[model samples]
Target: MALRTGPAHAENDPATPSQRQIYSQSIAEHYDYRFGANQPFLPSLATTDTGEFINSKAFPTAKYCGHCHQEAHAEWRQSAHANSFRTPWYTRNVNLLMAEKGIEYARHCEGCHNPTALVSGAMTKGSTINRKFDEDGVTCSVCHAIQKVDTRGTGSYVLAQPAVLVDEHDQPIYGEVSDKEILTHLDRHSKAVMKDFYRTSEYCSACHKAALPRQLNDYKWQRAIFLYDEWQLSSFAKQSPLPFYTKDSVSTCQTCHMAREPLGAIPDYGAKDGKLASHRWLGANTIMAKFYNYDVQMEKTVAFLKNNVFNVDIFGLEKNGSRMIAPLGTEPVSIAPGDILTASIVIQNKGIAHSHVPEQRDMYESWVEFEVTDSTGRVLTHSGTIEPNGDLDPRAHSFTNRLVNIKGEINDLHQVWNNRVVAYNNTISSGRSQIVRYQFKVPTDARGPITVTAKVNYRRFDQHFMDFAMGKDHYPMPVVDMSSRTRTFSLGENPATPPDPQDNPLWMRWNNYGIAMLDAQQYSESVHAFEQVARLRPDYPDAFTNIAIANFSWQRYDDSRTSLTRALKLSPHNARALYYLALVERNQGNLDAAIADLREVIAQFPRSRDAHRELGFSFYQQRKYNEARAEYETLQTIDPDDLAAHYILSIVYRRLGMADKASHEAAMFADQKDDPTASTYALDFLRKHPEVASESVVWHTHSDLEAAPSHGSNAPAQ
Candidate 1:
């Protein structure tokens, strides 16, 4: 439905019907005269009847929850989810990415991943969230208060007033239907109507999805994180009812992750009267469980995921113990110095329950490390390495993706440098594939087998980072080797090679490219260059995709999709293509077609994220909020603090119209105004967005309208 529009001051104008505006204006007036809209009707902090934590105190802390829920607490402590704010890894990378970009770009990541620390007023110049509350990460308050989810993948969850139960004397009281523990604090917990929208997948879309750059490629929607979407296209999304899969029996995320535990009988360990869902909330981060020495918790999480979700297929071993194929892609092919050598790597998001690399975490670093050397082992070429002090070599290629930061009007920076998240996210989606191409001159004097090695290296924290943030001894903060692969090229007795002229076609068709361009050595220059080509061939699908891809590299998913969709329509089923029509359908919040496309992709290319992420998202939109959250949450296990997963989950809360959730997510994007790369996403979004008439406006006291309520003349007699 189209939104109504009128003068900003039309409070009682019968021409328009939305009462929200009038309500907002009234609330705004109350704000000016009193505490205003910001006043949260929290239960009195001084109240004493709320249940006591394991330790009784006036104001119990999160630590109190740990006593009764020892297992959950311990797991949380080791997981990034627990250390959202104080994780040394996030701290160091956040500082680095922001330093290189700007502060405005960094906050987008901080919103969900480190919300407690960010909102506690901890983040600022030369300061990080390393305190008590911040250390607790996303505490109970963060989730319990989530009343709504936006679901459009914009990360627009809404925060709501505390649900309180009142007493006969009109005193405030609060109760937990989920827990038996009572608190000392009390508040009015009237049953507020929670819209079923909270259950839908659209709720996740609000934040998980990102918009593309309008300046570079025109505003388009790119599918950045697609966990929910991925599941929608999977067998899990289908109902077998009376068929092979079973009638009305469809697999849901909650079915596996949040399954209720059966009650059992015991003396001291007697189970609750009803079934209780496991709150361990575990996923793929077993390493974290190991880090805090929380072996039991880690083992539980690992066992749960390995037993429930997909299996891992590790490869890349050489027959003669010499070299292996690339860890992620297909076998490597030989090429001359000037040849545009091609290598296809298939880094499956195997273990993750949903999409891989869900969201933007400053410390979430994943890349293919490539080293080319002669048989003697002397390094001839290397990429994805950090220098001694802290800086990445200007010449080396990097696998770590980046977001855009558009803080200033004229100047734009990558999200790492600036705090703004204008648009553009470059992370591999679940069940998705990204192909990398590197062209180098085969040396004229090259002889024998020229070996090339590629490792899917992942690190929790950058090496030089800890010392830069928390001081020196924080050295060697573990960098885990998630996976690796390799291949050898026969450079046999090659004659002197001549320099090959550069082909601008790859640069000309940026839209066809995805993650590859995100790490392009000439990202900034290529952005402008591709834009010109797009302008020259405005109707060309490839041209649009090229420009769109550039915007996607900068984290502008919204804009990227527009062009990609057009490309798909113009040329369907192009194997070497980026976005499939079905994938676009799922991203646009379409379910059925997304399923079809995903199935088709699997039939054609067995390993694909297009189907999985889209399927998951579609299922989420289908009022399966818990299921959706589970899928996205599962992705985070593989890639901790994945921005895409968190963002999507936040949006699910927003679409449900949950106020607290919306506030949390809005905070993430609120500071985007200061980022250059982020500007493109927000600006294009607002411009193309059907304008929402002002929700709060002042109305002049003109003449009073006749009151018609209880009067025979259709007007109330005054």
Candidate 2:
């Protein structure tokens, strides 16, 4: 096929009996923007600047690019990107959305999944356009043609016109040229498609992040999956002090997903120094790869899942009737058959740059499977097991989300149109740890020795959803064990866990326990745990910082300051220490000192949400309205759903005599506010299932045991 100079010829044009652009018409009518089709690409479909549809024939196919970029093409062929649109699984999801709520609603999905179809008007009403591009599914041109990126997600890329060359007037030249002609204008070709931003995380954010808008669901704005923003605020971006594993530089999306690999013999046009960025965007899509029999990709995806992105550590046990904040596996211990215990497991999001199984928490299965057994092979108790019908044990501790509709119904399906609020979320953010306390009786008559096992597991999709999408012929979706730990309880006496090669250093293990204790609000135990970290790693600064965090949270401001001083003595420029020091100063009523330390912290990390939030509150306390407004405005851009910013900004607006702005901000504050009734939803579930509730009280914490989840428990400075 030659290079296309214009729109491809219409293929079997279909006539519509009714001229009504909606249900009376075709899919083309689905594209719209109730908020006006210009800003925030979700509703806009990210069409060309003029908001005009380009014909499908305008863009070249992957095969044309594969002729030269063979290695890259081959790698991409097995990737989730290539199968984004055409896969039977994806087709079923979008097809239903189109049917249930008019085709226009599906534009929310097709914008990211099948941009070629979207920008080319293939998704709208009775349209005659070359549909061949649909097979390419996020083809080579879709990424390379990106001219600009709007990091605020939901298909936020700006695409340039399709062209292989440009005229002297800087106009796009769309016709295909022969290899000999392209070799003569290789520089022009690079200029035509390649962009520096393509190598950036922001570029990935264009499609990776998503949100629900009023235009689609007839509701207020609500965030959907926000992998990009989540990463930006994690240790990966070096933008916060929340991480346990700290680094000096920002690790972009390409750093992990599109790892560079040797191209071997194939000539890859995009190769740099004997390596090309692997196009097999390794993700949690083992199901799709197996369905398509792309074994190599499937294997790689599984390997990625098990490649130490997260770790599961069965730390300790809490004897029932005698509650102890997981003191960790330190020193020898004793256990008896008649005793009931609560097993403590710590799940650390160690190396992942974003949340584990990010962006698909609502669909993917990620959970902690806990089991206990006796020497006689008698099953004591198991929380996470597959039922005969393929459903997971409903009470399993899962690292997933539950987005609810206005009526409080759970939308397990990936229906973007139905999302209203995050009713439940337990996904561990990067460099964070989650604690799962499972309590069970030891069985008085059971065998002496008890073996306990816990694992972090991943499945591409649950049985129910897969069955719904695939219909009668249910294809098997394999489960991947991401991380696991096993411990044994002896007859009368049990030694601490024997050191393992895979375990974190003893000091770090103690620190992990301390972090978990802080999350559970066991301040004395948390402080004791951090003190152990200090004793083991006296040279490490974070040990002291950890102690300070516990003290600060416990309201021992003087003791907190003492630890911070020691931490600073070890590392003068420790940002985490300095950030915590600021918190102490603010708590002690030293506003000026607190402001200085916060300013210094902000200088090192301009994107620090905590710094901006605290600074804004400080200024508001000093009654410096202008300065406070600037900080709050900056905070709003960093985290749009911040409750404090919305509430305080509403007051700031009124103080500035902007009554209209104040009134509007008040509504956002209410909208973004956490649903007090959401607590009742979990209570209702517990009431219905007293059997599960009787095990023990469960505490689910999101922060890395930070003193404050976001802002400190202290209300924003009056």
Best by TM-score: 2
lDDT of each: 0.41, 0.73
Number of clashes in every candidate structure? 165, 8
Worst 10 residues of 1 by lDDT: 693-702
TM-score of 1: 0.44
lDDT of 1 at 390: 44
- lDDT string for model 1 (566-684, tens) is 66666676322343444445556667776565555545544343333444576676877766665555554333234455566677777667769657645543422233355564454
How high is the lDDT of residue 289 in model 1? 56
Give the root-mean-square deviation of each candidate in angstroms: 21.5, 8.0
lDDT (Cα, tens digit) per residue for candidate 2, span 1-718: 2232232212221111121122222333554433454532346336565445555555777888887789999888888888889887789888877788766666778788988777766665555666777777988877877777776677877775466665455555563445555566677778777778888888898788876656677755666778877888888888887566687777889998999988778798789889998899998887888888888888888888888887777777767557553434555667787786777788888888888767546778787877777898777777666665776666677777665555555566777577655545667777777788777777788886888888888888877788878885344678788888887778687766557766677887778878877876788978998998899889989888889999999999999999999999999977889889988998889989888888888888888888899999999998888888999889877766677988998999999999998998899888756556655655554455554443224363111111112211111100
Root-mean-square deviation of candidate 1: 21.5
Candidate 1 runs further than 4 Å off: 1-68, 88-135, 140-356, 359-363, 390-401, 404-425, 440-450, 461-468, 471-475, 488-718
